[model samples]
Target: MIDYLDLALQYGGFTSLDKVYLARKLAGLTDQQKLDFITPPPSVINAYFAEIYQKQGAEEATDYYLTLSQQLSLFPKEPSFAEEKPFVRLNLSGKAFGFAYVDGTGLAQVFAEQDVEVAENLLFEIAQIFPHYVVFEQAGKVWMKGNDFDETILMAEETEFLLTDVSVSDQFVKISGLNQEEVLQAAEKYDGQRYVAWSGRSAILYIKH
Candidate 1:
């Protein structure tokens, strides 16, 4: 196994925490994915600054990568502690996903693609990969999968407005345990985009600008 941590350090563009997360993420990759992540030599990245100094293992190469990371500003990432943790990070076809418990939810499922397996086969295979979160596409909608899920809770008449379904629109945002004004004020900074952050059980959603 390649020492991802040392590789990140040698790259020298990440903070201590970011490197740890980067290493963890890289460790899960198939070998091909790791190969795809290699940074091209600076000359290939930008010939504007291209010089003979762009060769690999050269000090200039290190400086160029460092400059690239700084230009990208892909650092200082801090994890958010939240009430609902994500089941898995999906590397889907340009789609990102995360979900919250709508209540009475149970079990965790993980799914990456829907090309081969049908629903019955997926359900059977899920147990083989026991104790891992599953995600799958159903009715053209993506959802987390779990065998123990009791969907009855979804029909509860007492459903207090859920940010997910009740209202989700561009400029709409939710900050759990906050009032409408606070959530809206936060959205104001977006100049507007649909977003939400979960913490406690309750949250205020802003549906309009």
Candidate 2:
């Protein structure tokens, strides 16, 4: 197995303090979990950097983009099974879900879906092999597989919020059961602690903290 911490320090371009923090956080994870957390698809990394560059500046995004590119370059390229046929079909609660294999790049491509649980289960299974970041859409809301940093924050009346959908990747959170105006009103209460963006019926709240 690779020493992820050493690799991060040598080539990931993280500061010494940041690498130490990451090492501590990743210390308890299983080998497979470590791989999953460290090795996301190049496309996903690019998309993340693009978003950051758009919001932040090139100076702010350069280190992350370079580090991620270096990390991916160290891994051998895997074939995308998505081009072939469906990798597996899952039947849950009288619903059919199709999943296409995208190598072991932590990319979970869902061909079909019924509920959030199904999507979560499929991604979890894929993680065992690819051990990378995964994303899917559920309940008309987009969800990305995240670590503990992305926590579940329950509000009144069964309203739920997810803080940071992609772990330490960003401070964006997902808000369900809230409309644009409602989330905006709630944001005002936060006193600029967060900003709300509309995604269909769901709201993506970017947290300052």
Candidate 3:
């Protein structure tokens, strides 16, 4: 396996102290080896940098990913902690482009397509992959795959409310738990597109700003 500690220090743009702390945390590697790893030839360093940049688009993704440990605490664990841990980091590579980490909830994937035609086609393809999906409108409308349609869409608001029944307007559930400020902020940040899924649960919520 690749040495993640060395990689973080070398390419994560950490300060000198950060590098020292990272070096200390690394297992088994000698100081000389770590130095050599950092002091590679110019061409090799540039290639390494290029590869790192290619794999990770920005710091945000890395920061978000590292927060998995903290996020785990928000959820109720299974009978065993061993079984509960590694849920979020349990990424099946190439499964999806984006994923959400919910507390008691499950994981959710978000696919944002600028092209309507492409998105529509992808939506159909996604439905075929899963039996049923949740549907909601972001800045643009979206269709989910799953049986819990009411749970997902009912959470959608004209501005940001849930729709209990697609055919009827009377039945609805206002999304609770999240504070009003957070909801407003999400609406602004997502520009009206926020979908959520909880782990081990079929329920999916599609939030539209």
Candidate 4:
């Protein structure tokens, strides 16, 4: 229900660099550790409370804020994965990737067992990294859907992404800007869970369900 990218861009005024920095820091820490950096101050909490109750005309505040706080990147995650489902589980035996950001792009936290945050070129570099990776599940695939993140984000808002889960070989995910070698290396990192079919300016991250 929460849009992670929107929170950062709209509420936090997060720059592309800020997002990358957060993702890099997040990839290393445990859940408890993550809370320390991401927890919004009283001002941010007040803004969210106002947005939900005062501005949006919500009847309640406490419960809503609790749920909202858990999903937002500015606030630390206290809830578990009960409601927030990941777009893709981390690849088997995959090592955690360090800081990596493309030009005018966001970060990619390719971690081991933990999710890869966002694949890049999301609403704002990695605009789709909602709460965690739930936004991607709620939105569209960034690379394959369109060349522009705004266009794709609008598309996600307008309609539901209908792509079904299938074999990794049957899928053709595309991440623009990566060369063939880089693409292959990414797939290899996912163990046998993902495969890169072909690449030009775009590479595939066909994840096995």
lDDT of each: 0.35, 0.43, 0.36, 0.34
Error of 4 at 3 (Å): 13
Query: Which lDDT tens digits does candidate 3 get at residues 103-149?
Result: 32333333331223334334433433332334343444343323342
TM-score of each: 0.20, 0.24, 0.24, 0.26
Ranking by lDDT: 2, 3, 1, 4
Model 3 lDDT at residue 158: 44
1 against 3, candidate with superior lDDT = 3
Q: After superposition, how far is residue 140 of candidate 4 from its true place, in Å?
A: 48
Span of ten consecutive residues with least summed lDDT in model 2: 160-169
Give the residue spans of candidate 4 off by over 4 A.
1-17, 60-64, 72-209
Q: Which stretches of candidate 3 lie over 4 Å from their true place?
A: 1-96, 101-104, 112-119, 141-146, 149-209
lDDT of model 4 at position 73: 34
Residue 162 local lDDT, model 3: 38
Q: How many residue pairs clash (N, CA or C atoms closer than 3 angstroms) in each of the candidate models, in the order given?
A: 6, 1, 19, 1
Q: What is the alpha-carbon lDDT of model 3 when measured against the actual structure?
A: 0.36
TM-score-wise, the better of 1 and 2 is: 2
> 26 in model 3: Cα distance from truth in Å?
11
Error of 1 at 124 (Å): 66
